[model samples]
Structures are given as C-alpha cells and as structure tokens.
Target: MRSVASRFAPYQELAEHLLQATISEPMDAAHDVGHLLRVWGNAERLMAEEGGDRSVLTAATLLHDCVHVPKDSPLRLSASSMAAEKAGRVLDSLNWTAGDVEKVRHAIEAHSFSAGIVPTTLEAKILQDADRLDAIGHIGIARCFHVSGQMNRPICDLFDPGADRRALDDRAFAMDHFQTKLLTLTGSFQTATGRRLARVRHDKVRDFLNGLLEEVLPDAMTVSH
Candidate 1:
C-alpha cells in the first residue's frame, strides 16, 4: 500500500505540509491517518474512471476530516462545513487561488452525510463517495465497532437487536446504524465507479449483518425465554 504522501504524487509536498501542520492534531481512531489514506485510495480508484482534478481532490481528501466533532455532538451536522472553513484557511496560507480554494471548500463541505449538502462538482461527488465508501464493507465493520466502543454505544439492543420491536436509534446501538445508514449507502453513490464498488462492499456489510443476526438473535431469544 502506498503511504499517504506517495498517494498525492506531484502534490505530495502539499499533503506533507498539511499532515505536519493541520493533521498533526489529536483525532479519534476513526478519523486518523489510516482513514485519510483509505479515503484517498478510494478517491484514486474513482478518479481512474470518473475523471476529476487530482490536485483539488488530493487536498480535499486529506483535509476532509480536519475538524473532528464527536458523533454525538450537537455540532456533528456542521463538522464538514467547519472542516471546509479550516481547509480554506490552510490553502490560503499555501497561496492557492481563491477559485481553487472555493472548489476545495465545496468538496470538503459537501462530503459529509450529516451536512446534507448536495455535491455540485465532480470532485465533490468523488470525495463524498470515497469517504462514504470507507463506511461500509470490512474496514467499515472495524470502524463501526471502534467508534461504538469509543462512545460506549452497545453493539446491539440484545433482546431486540434488529429493532423489530422498537424504534431504531444508532446512537444507542451500533447495529441500528446498519439499518439507518450503512446498508443503504450503495444507492447513494455519486459516480458509476463508486456505485459499482459500493454494490460489492454493500454485500459484505449485508453478509456480516446476516451472520451477526444468525448468531445473536437466537441466543437472545433463548435468553428471553
């Protein structure tokens, strides 16, 4: 696997500068360097076919999560906009053109699912897809539990793990997130490549959810009886 610096190619210096400056701050396990690299990797795959400005995509992908609000924070919905604002400042320091800065800002701001901003540019669409791609499949499985642990959210509701009898609240149960978001993400892909890759990863998530249901549901039923 390529290092995050190597992934940026001719723009590696820019990536390195931000990594040392902005990215050096403390972050949760889910939003750390590994996540950045994975998102960039996903972006590269999408760019290979979707076609977007590499320099802008590189900067946006690197700084997309520069601001990390806790998942439960009231500020969570604005996290992407805040990150975009910070990215604009960082790029201004590096002397990027105002137009280019705005492009990066839009990509970063629209990339968040919670932010609910529709991506208008190809780069923004690609960034959004790439970031979301990291939220499904096997890696996504690990990330999900990692975050749940961090927030002390339970893996499921135990007696009603599937929430068949209760309201769905991902905040209270990690498994509920599958129903609320992760499982439905494939349909939300912005590009053809992203959608194609998403279908494959979506299956992995479904299979994992199925396997978990098989193991846990019966046990819960047994305990309830």
Candidate 2:
C-alpha cells in the first residue's frame, strides 16, 4: 500500500541503487531480479503483518544478493564479498548514514546460510526468512534443480541416499538447501507471523521432497507433475 519513498527517502534511494547494481549482474536462477523481487514482496507482507520496520526490510531484500555468488564456488564467494564492498560504496555515494549502511550491509552479508551469518535484528531475520522461503516449494524446487545444473552437481533424492547429510557444506547447497536454509528457517524467524508462513511453506517443500523420494524408489518415474 504505502510506497517506500514517502516513508524513508534515504533507504529508498539505497534500494534503487541496489536494484541497478544487482540487475547488472549475470544472474540466471536463484539470484535473478525477479527472484529478488519475490523475496522482497514476501518480506514486505511479513514485515507489515509482524510490525517490523519496512524500510530496513526492503533495503535488506534489495542488497542481500547484490553480491551473492554460488555457495560452493570460493572464487565467486570472494567476488561476492568484493561486490558487497562495492555495494557499500554505492550506498555511501547516496549519502546513506554510516549506521544504516552498516545495518543493511551486515544483514546482506549474513543472509547466506553457508556464510553462517545469524540474524540479530528483526530486519535481518525477515530478510533471512524471505530468502530462505524462496528456496522451497514449487519455485524453490525449480531453483534448486537449476542451481544443481549450475554447480554441475548430481541430482539425488533430497530425503535419502543421494542427499548429503553433512552439515553446512557449500557444495551440497543445491538440493540440501532444503535442510540448511529452508528447513532451518522454520524456527529462525523472529516473528510469530514469519514462523507461521515458514511452517506452511516449509511443509510444501518437505511434502514435495517426500513425493519425489517415493518416486525415486523404482517404477515411479512415470508419475506426472
């Protein structure tokens, strides 16, 4: 309902900068502009319902992936960090305050599951949950498989034999994303509203995983979507 500019001019300016920078990247699957917008949309809804700060949430959403590279690629991760620094500079150019920029930048950097950056603020948690939510359900499945293709990782039933159960490895981020970020998001949400949404969305992915696992046993490939 209410637009961003009428609320906080500084954050809205930073968000616009983030938009231009992220859109310039060579993103295809998980990090695309459409996907980022979806996460921000979800964050907006949850933040409004939960009474969190909308401007900060929006800033986190836009900047979170401005430098996000694939989890397994160390080179990309380094590149991502450099890009994040550049994003900070971009924000600085907009005259955003040091405190607000630090807050936004920390949330952006900590939003990654593999990075092990835990959320300490409601804005951070909202951003984390929104990003995590995108990694599940129908869209999430497609993104996961798409990511697997990018990583050249083998496809495996996430519920069993092929899914690596090890903890927090970036190479396993594609399919195992369900476990690392998606599933964990169920509890990590800062607000009750987020937990509710996360639980429902989380169930969709879990059910999807179970159905896929059942099909993987044998003679089930003929089942249609």
Top candidate by TM-score: 1
All candidates: CA RMSD (Å):
3.6, 5.3
TM-score of each: 0.94, 0.77
Rate residue 42 of model 1 by lDDT: 97
Q: What is the alpha-carbon lDDT of model 2 when measured against the actual structure?
A: 0.65
lDDT by residue (tens digit), candidate 1, 125-161: 9999999999999998889999999989999997899
Superposed model 2: Cα runs more than 4 Å off: 1-15, 75-84, 157-181, 218-225
lDDT of 1 at 114: 92
* Count of clashing residue pairs in every prediction: 0, 0
User: What TM-score does model 2 achieve against the real structure?
Assistant: 0.77
What's the lDDT for residue 218 in model 1? Answer: 65
